[model samples]
Target chain A: MHQSRLTRWFFQNVGLASALLLFAVLFLSYNMMHPRGFSAAVAVQNANETAAIAFLAMAQTLPVLLGGLDLSVGAVMTLTNCIASELVNGSPAQILFGIVVTLLSGAAFGLMNGLIVVYGRIQPIIATLATGAIAIGLALLVRPKPGGDVDGDLGWALTNSVWDFADTYGIAGGGDAWWIRPFADIPVPVIIVLLVTILVWVPFRRSVTGRTVYAIGSAEGAAFMSGLPIERAKIAAFTLGGFFAACGGLYLAIQTSSGNADIQQAGAYTLNSIAAVVLGGTSLLGGVGTAVGSLIGAGILRVISFYFRILDIDPLLQPLIEGVVLLVAVSFGAIRTLRVKNKLDLFR
Target chain B: MRISVSNENKPILIASLFIVVILLAGTVYTLSTAGTAPLLSPKYLLQQLQTGSFLGICAAGMMMVILLGHIDLSIPWTLTAAAMTATAVGGEMALPTALAVGIAVGMLNGFGVAFLRIPSMIFTLGVDTVLRGLMVAQTGGFAPQDTATPLMLFLAKDRLLGIPVALFVWAAVSVFIIVMLTRTGFGRSIYATGSREGAAYLSGIRTRFVTMGAFVVSGLCASIAGVLLAGYSAKAYQGMGNAFLLPAIAAVVLGGTHILGGRGRYIGTLIGVILIVLLNSVLSIMQMPEAGRQIIYGTVIIAMLLVYGRNQRVTS
Candidate 1:
């Protein structure tokens, strides 16, 4: 019986498992093709880029867990990035103030979305889409052009390896030999991701509010009937989502050392977040999956492009591959539709 | 078989009134500032109608899908792909090529949603990405060399009896759609399926087929719009269809159609199209930046949804 339960757990988390496996294989292939096998510099570069999308995916995962979608996460990230680039300059005190303001503004946007969906009774998709438009507008207002500067020291602090092995050990840019070293020496962004997973996600998953969110996603009517705090749970989930998106924006600001009001980039991030959440085994129908899975999912997505670059494949084919992978990943969940005994269940 | 305007349609009635108010507002603003003729002048109104015809054609198709309680977010890429294919083919084959591309995509979307039972939103989005990639690859990330065909240009630019031919095409398409929804059994099936698929299936309606048919119609309409758009611009360009998706959806929803499907009218959608076109012209006239325009569009949709969409029962 114990063995059966273990097997069932394995089967249930197959999406996460596959995502991890895919990431590993792609990372290996990329390292093989790259002139520098797995140097610290390369690791830092990868971590910095992946962390942003991973954060956005985590934000998306929260809403999906509550049986809703938040299309505005990407826009919130863009808005915060713009704000950060504009304010995160000069003195250390000013940078700290800018970070707080950016995060608060992101949360404010999320609160607005939550209110619209909860109080205004608008559908999540449409409500978030509307708010996303507004967020993009705000982002454009902050930085009409991509010319703002972020604090160089802050950017270096976030993007560089926590321990500079290259400088300390006399290794030139931590040259290709340290591929086998543990991920402990990974970049600060990777550390931030780990911290977030342990600190924010773990506590939230165990808390009553998190369980309430799951309950609402699984069966809102039943949860409402049970007198659970459905409204509070939903609002909290969206607010948390906004907070995470702001984290992503901060990462982006540090990575680029600037801001851009590029709608295309925001749109790409939004679509990719949905794809990552699905690949991570989170059901779009809601009430399933975890943030860790989405992190791996984001890694898988990023590695695919990285792998393509290593192989010198045309960049145009990247979207095609990504789309196919997303469709296939999503289709895995749909396979259950064939087994529905009652035709009506298919609609649900 | 004419379904009378019921109490549920009061929102649409109010929307019609709102359109008039906006028209007057736009005219007054234009007249006061530039001392130009009112935008309500026949020539200006005709121009606005002509511009609206492009959106109207696409929205007409979108309305069918919305009526069935499903959405096709793939419209932008599908429209772009069709336009690219048509222009690349050039000459007399352009129209047919575009229509074929639309039908093909529509069928693909239909198969996934109806047969495989995948969610339309995600499935169409995936298809859209793939199409976008393929189009980019074909164009080598640059504007295509081929331009719109002679026939397409004539259809888009030439006028008959002082009205744009595009307007006439839109009228013809509108008449067909209105008849399909009001008089045909297929139309009835679409409404029945959208409102409640299980009940419709139990009553011996082919719900899957109806669902597929709605997607096909939507795809076809989107492709036609792409052709017209290319004709208007004289050439196909990358990301040409990007601007239409939100506007098409907003028009459908603003027309008082339930977002989850079942109840709506083409006449209301027609009014919605005019309102959007006029609104676009006014915003442009005011020289508002792109960001302001997007904010206004989003705000208007939210406000309209609060008034009309909130009350409808979403069976899906």
Candidate 2:
């Protein structure tokens, strides 16, 4: 019984451990390359990258949890950034307002996707793909080029420092701040990622609403028969996903400090978001995953990229590795699903 | 015997509608611009047609996969791989050899999906990446300088008694696919497997093999596309196939082939590819920015899907 439970747990939670392993490897490797590098600074940078990817993955996760995949996450991210830049302009007030607008835009997009999937009776993949294209088109209409500045002072304020020791550069006591200028101090995106975990993921996944997501993911028809708000939960999941993707875009805007359509156009976030979620032991078939696992997954990907950089591997090789990673991850998920289905069939 | 509209006619009707609308739009725009030059100058339209012909050729392959309710996301990379292979073979090798290699790759794709039981999207995507890496490694991240055989150049550039030879190739391939789809057992198998694999399998069809065959056909189509592209350009580059990816899928989808696999026709894809080519040609004539063109491209495809969806439910 214990062994069976352990196997189930491994299938369910292997993603987090993978993420942790990735983080540790990347941490050590990055240090090996830059021996004099500030550990805290690297950690902070890793966190920021993690938050952005986590949110993006979570956004995609909602649809997947419902046995749907959204291919338009990349387009949505680009569009959100473009709209935010146009709306937010260069004021601090605009920044705050932009956040709201971005989330709302994501929600609006998600709502449309949900409605189509439910009412149009189209497959979720197809429906979401069309919606994603629509969102991207809308984004293109807003910003043709990657030109727009966030309020520099605001960007700095948000991305810069908190305590005296932790400026945009590395921490205070870590040698002259001159050597660490490139690796700026505590990133706000990381803080937001942590807060989101505490606020959104913790209570939500544990709550009835979260369970509804899982139940629906496990079996939509069953969930519906059991009196769950199937359509609403799907909409909620997608909406939250859009909001998170938007949040990712916002952080990306800060990271690059400018808005270009091509920023993060590498398609990394789209694939990685899915990978991270799956790696975090969130079933690709959906209805099973944790934000913490996603967080870890995101960290692992970043670490992998960092390692590639450290090892001086060709940029193209990264995609190859990612492809392998995706195959391995999905294969694992597929085998597990096959096992569970078989076991359940035995009872029948 | 009452002859009700057969399932085949549906794609025909939709394709006709698209052709009419696109032609009308093109004509109207041409008329509006007639004062500057002849509204539909043969030279001008021919140039536009030629420019988008490459995309049309590729969409032909991509559409077949979609008809099977599977996608070759790696068309982009496959295109790259074919180009690399063709470029390496150069003008000295017989066209048959180059063509054979391309077909082999397609067969490999079929094997991966049908035999390996992997998802088409992920599997093809992996193939695309691996091939891209191979291409980059082979060409060292540069467009290869290759000399096309005289035959290739003639095929790509020369007209056959006033019609382009490429047009001949297109016609032949289309007829082949159309017949294979409508007349052959394999074609029926493709539709059956895509629309309802479980039922098809129970009915004694080798669904896995059929799915695999569809992928091989898809690969064949992509490879042929590469050959045409290489011939047209006189050489292949590392990223020569990059732009073909979205539009190939778009053409297939727009042709009214269900993105989810099953229940589509080659005719739909053919018209869809033509429509997209014409649209882009017209847009470029208007001097639109590259980015704006992308925005418009995405919007138009979505709009087409929405319209197609409504019609699909009504008819089905």
Candidate 3:
């Protein structure tokens, strides 16, 4: 009986498990095809790129868990990138202040979205769609063109290896340096990702508010009837989404070492995040999935592009392939709909 | 479960009045500043009406999809794909081929949503991305060399009497749509399916067929809009249809159609289309930057949604 139960759990989490496997295979293949052969610099560069979308995917997961979608997350990320680029310059104190303000602004955008949805009675999709436009407008206003610098020190610290082990041990650069190889392999972005997963997502997952979010997603009427503080939970979920979106923007700024208010990029991120969430096994209808799943999903999506590059496929076909992948992944989730006893339940 | 005709007409009536007020206000502002009311001039108004016709056609289709509580985000790419196909296939075969492509895509969307049980939003979005990629692959990142056919140009840009032929085509299409929604059993089924899919199914409405039909109609309208747009521009280009998606949706929602489906009017959407066209013209006249324009466009949708949404909550 226990073995059967374990098998059931494994099947239930098949999406996440498959995603992990896909990610591992893709990463390994990419490393094999890469000329550098799994060096720290290469890993850090790839990790930095993956971290941005991963953070955005994580941001999107919370609202999806609450049965709401936040289309403004990408716009918030763009806005924060613009804010950070404008303010995260000069002295370290100044950069710290800029980062704080940028994060706060992201939270504010989320608060506005929550209020509009909860109080204005507008649907989440439409509300966030509007706010997303406004956020993009704000981003454009902040950075009319893409040419603002962030603090150099902060950028280097976040994007580089944690320790320059070869230099620390007085070994010359470009040597086989076996002893310091593992130390140099630790990318700062990867470490930050781990820290966030442990510090934020793990605790949040076990909290009452988090449980309430899932409850609301699963069945809002039942949650409300049971006095589950629906409003507070929703607001908190959206706010945290904004916070994470800002983190994504901050990472983008660090990685690029500049800022851009490109609506195309923002729109792509929003769509990709949704795709990632689905890839992660999170139900769009809400109430299931985890942050780890989203991380893996993000990794899978990023690696797909890299895998394509390695295979020498035309770059133009990327969106087409990605779309097919998304459709197939989402359809997997929909298979259960076929079993509904009543056709009407299909609409629900 | 049927809404009274009078109740349905109320929102349209109010929207029409609002459009008149906006036009007059814009005219006054223009006249006060420039000593002439160019926007109110018959010629300019007629020209703007031609532009509004494109959006009206697209919104007309969107209204049907929205009526069924599903959205077709693939409109932009579907339109683009059709236009590119038509233009590339130029000459007499252009119009029919373009429309056929739209219908094929629309049917695919419907099949996925109805038979495959995939969510309309994601499914259509995926279809859109695929279409976008196909178009890009076809064009190799440059504007197509083929020009719009003479017939397309005549339909889109030529005048009949003192009015644009586009306006007449839009009128014909709108009239047909209005009849479909009001005078046909299929129209009633659409509303029923959107309002309560299960009940509609139980009532033998063939909800899947209705859903597919709505999508097919939407796809047809979008393709027609694309053909017209190609005619206006004289050539189809990459990303040409991108500008229409949000505005088409915004116009439909602004017309007070429930975004969740089951209630709305074609007249309201008509008025909504005119308002957006006029607003765009006025904003252009004022020389507002693109960023400011987007902000206003988004704000307007939100304001209208709040006003309409509040009423919905109270009634429910």
lDDT of every predicted structure (CA atoms): 0.85, 0.68, 0.84
lDDT by residue (tens digit), candidate 2, B108-161: 677766655555666676677667766765666777777566777777778877
Worst 10 residues of 2 chain B by lDDT: B307-316
Q: What is the lDDT of residue B87 in candidate 2?
A: 66
Which of candidates 1 and 2 is the stronger one according to DockQ?
Answer: 1
lDDT of 1 by residue, B235-307 (tens): 8898888877777877887887877789888888988888889888888888889889878877877887787
lDDT of 2 by residue, A70-175 (tens): 7777777877777666665455576678778877886677777776666565666655555665666576677767777665654654553343235432356442
Question: For every model shown, what is its TM-score relative to the native structure?
Answer: 0.93, 0.84, 0.92
Among all candidates shown, the one with the greatest DockQ: 3
Instruction: For residues B1-316, write the lDDT of model 3, one tens digit per residue.
Output: 9855465666566667767877887788888888788877899999999988888999999999999989898999998899999999998799999999989999999998888887787788888888987887778778889999999999999998989999998999999999999999999999999998988998889999999999999999999999999999998998888778777887887787878889988888998899889888888877888789778877877876665554333211
> A233-263, model 1: which lDDT tens digit per residue?
8888898899899989988997898999888
CA shift of A158, model 2, Å: 4.6
Q: lDDT at A126 for candidate 1?
A: 74
Fnat for the candidates in order: 0.49, 0.17, 0.52
Docking class of 3: medium
Order the candidates by TM-score, highest first — what do you get? 1, 3, 2
How far is each candidate from the true structure, as Cα RMSD in Å?
A: 3.8, 5.1, 3.6
Q: Give interface RMSD, every candidate, in order.
A: 3.2, 5.9, 2.7
Chain A vs. true chain A, TM-score per model, equals 0.89, 0.81, 0.89
Q: Which ten residues in a row have the lowest lDDT in candidate 1 chain B?
A: B307-316
